[model samples]
Target: MPRSTFHRILSPLLLWRLRHINDRVYLILMSVLVGLAAGLAAVLLKTSVHGAQQLLYSWVPEEKRVFALFLYPIIGVALTVLFTRYFLGGTLSRGIGPVIYNIARQNSIVPRSKMYSQLVTSFLTVTFGGSAGLEAPISVTGSALGSNLARILRVSRRERRLLVGCGAAAGVAAIFNSPIAGVLFAVEVVLSELSAPFFIPLLISSATATVVSKGLYEGQPFVLITNSWPVQAIPFYVMLGLGTALLSVYMLRVYFRADDFFERWPGTFRKVVLGGLALGLLVFLFPPLYGEGYNIVQALLAGKPEQLTDSSIFSVYRDENVWILLLVATASMLLKVFATCITVGAGGNGGMFGSSLFTGALGGFVFARLINLSGLYPISEVHFIVLGMAGTLAGVVHAPLTAIFLIAEITGGYALFVPLMLVTSSSYLISRYFEPYSVYTRKLVQKGVIVHADRDRGLFAQLDPLSMVQTDFMPIHPESTLGDLVTVFRHSTRSIFPVVDAEQQLVGLVTVDTIRDALFDDEHYNTIRVADLMAPPPAIIEPGDSLLDTLGSMDQHGAWALPVVNKGKYVGFILKSAILAGYRRQLLKESE
Candidate 1:
């Protein structure tokens, strides 16, 4: 062979071999990078929001301290209006739907356009005075980093999906300094798949991110919880869990409804501008709702429980104003829901996790007050606050394990595990029973994406590929002429046919549509070979491969049907319909 010919073959072969060996390693390294980036982004975004708020406060005269409080929302609304209008294509963005869509369909490539939009919008949402949190941007940034990195390395579609999860896990782990929680959140909330193939990478990425985050922030827990409450709180925890679950479902519904209503507006920018104006006015009246509510949480934890009140238009002071806090917390909870819906529904970019936490805290406070009235051992309201946080999150995300672990990690204690687990589990179970979907899955389902998993493993194990194989499949040979192909396909019952060489080596695939298209061309009247019309080798599946994996591959490719080849020889085929019917059959059998 000539040198050029030899080199061409050799280059691809070497690259392919090297890629096969190095892809996993590259994913691991990128995971670490995502973790670090997410950690830094969270910290910087948080600081910028606070610093801006402080600077705004300073600009006002000391006599205008209370006036400045209302001004906080004005600042947030103005900046958010500018950013959302100019940067986000004038649409309110929400959660990780775009990221998930890209991962599932577009190979996880997030445009820098959307990436920056989320970063700025989320910052303004929380910092400028929106009743949301930074967690949305953190997850988006992490997924974007992984997607961009994976694209650079030319990773496979499956690996790209895994990387999205890894990056998300890393972001969560770093933000909360809870590796296990991060991993579980990735598995349970993000991927929504529990599989051996994904666990290792998710775990490693989360652990790495947590370590990296700790290095930068000195390993402080996110919530700074210190408690030695007795185990008697389990029953109350259950109540808290169930209550939070019901409340989360209600909030999610309202949020989506608000989003729908806003989107129905005649114009995009007008709706957003109007929403911003409304938010400005509301925050102007009730200024403490201006940010992520972290400062509010701190105040509550410091024993100023009296700050909660029934008024709708007062500032959230750092001092414990129980009545004020009650009013603000309840109003804040409702307003946060609406703000999130408007922010995303109006095309402002951001996430819901942060809002969920804030809502949980509010719900917890309410629950605690109710319990206190019942003469329960005066458990600190802060304790109820923590439970409410986890319970609500668990219901919203539908990930009890992740929720419980996150609470423990965020609070820096396993001491509350009894209550945490009880509440989280109950909330998750209740939410799932009512809706049968998490926020992520609901978005995916809306987009017509199917989430396939190995839930019915025993059915798969018992199934024989041959049993599901189509009895009659169209076939063609390399030597077959155009006329021969036409003749065979004309009488064929099947829509598709597998083409093979004389030696029966798997060659290509052709369909009746191809034959018809060819007939419209002058080439069909000549002696063109069957190989000429056939596609390149089809996606072949071996006998030993799991049926679930085969099904996933077919679904991933949207293949109408796939050829099953054994040792390069055509064996059988499986239709998509059969797979679906088989799934139904298995479900019936299990029910029986």
Candidate 2:
């Protein structure tokens, strides 16, 4: 069936049912459904990636697993690029930026295919050592589910955006099994607001998703346990917070530098192949940077600093160097940033969530080890590891609340909550002072985009000038008579007609207001021409004019509508009625 034919048949049924159901009730119900689906997606993605990683790595001998891990990243990332370019049009993005962009510009409507695309692509990327996280990709998949369902259901734009947020919250909760962090993440990153109406729905969605996740997967306390912080550790915690804040700054800079490096690669194939090679070199040398590096994090928390020490390529080459382990631990922070940037910039997939976790673990371990080496106050490396995760996350994501709650929830205790808050708050403030936007939103804020949440500029930015144009206006030749213009008006309901030359160039406009006397005088019928009765328009709208500027022109001329011109040809009339309606709708949504 044709799209027009489909819409013709589907629209009435949608509107009929839409009117019957209370919108609030419908949204609450949809939020639960969206949460279930998003939770399922997260579970599926996690299982798929774990399966693929196991299957691929199982083929390698255990003795050479470290060495062979280097090649896996290259193969996984390059194959992802090939599949994307050849089969998926290379348009599938594995990040939250596009989600934000859509909500801002496209009214929260996403392509239906995005519901699965990120899952497939990100699974391939992370499973084979893309050094990226699945959390962002899963959120994107859930967001698509919510957005496309809204498109199918023909929901209002405002409601659609909220559904998208619910989906994101569900994805995050399901992945981490932390509903509070999930809601906070949705508010800080996706929704960009904390409206009361959006809160209950987002909370319910996240809680539901967490329940689904726990129902399917046995919930394990996230960690290797360690002793609680000592009273003497307070000063050390403050110093570590300052250190993590500085490391966070360095990590952010390193990420963009790596992205810039990969972006400059000339050819698509060269980009993928070369980027993979660089990542492979890092993995070959460091070994622990091979995947998400979670096993290494586990090792660090378990008091086996020897795990990273042995895997350090520096140790492999320069044996018995006491400082080599600490050097490698510090270097992993920078190398992980590079590997992650290469993964995404070279067209692999995944996000900063996993990368930050790995880097923070390294930073924490390094800090404690250095402190002990200095013969100062001793700190538990395990406890510091948790703090490091929150601190780095707070800086990289610019959401201190999310970072704090994530650590607190996952640990199932507030034993580390005080330090977590201290580090995260300091890191977030410092990061904001230096780099205001998170990795996800840097480009968006710089470009002045909207998230359907901006009240002043976003509303106007979203209303496309071309979409508001009424193009059905009839054009009368300038040399034609007033009788000719009258005949044109008889068949058309519009009061305004453009006077065009032989080439259809708009020369003047004739309105019912200006031709009242001519219409009453039938005696001067053929004696008058369109050119005599038509007047030069007080204002004209060009195709590229913004809503604010265009509306300002109309206001200045005291006109309700204006003729649209593109290049030198007449297009149509852009009515203040349409512009005002769009503005009012956006205003109400923003205020809500």
Q: Which candidate gets the maximum lDDT versus the true structure? A: 2
lDDT score at residue 127, model 2, on the 0-100 scale: 87
lDDT of 1: 0.70
* Clashes per candidate (backbone, < 3 Å): 29, 1
For residue 324, give model 2's deviation from the true position in Å. 2.2
- Once fitted onto the true fold, the runs of candidate 1 whose alpha carbons sit more than 4 angstroms away are 1-24, 62-93, 194-197, 218-227, 306-325, 452-592
- Model 2 worst lDDT window (10 residues): 310-319
For 118-149, candidate 2 gives per-residue lDDT tens digits of: 88888888888888888898898889988877
At residue 562, candidate 2 shows an lDDT of 92
- Maximum-TM-score candidate: 2
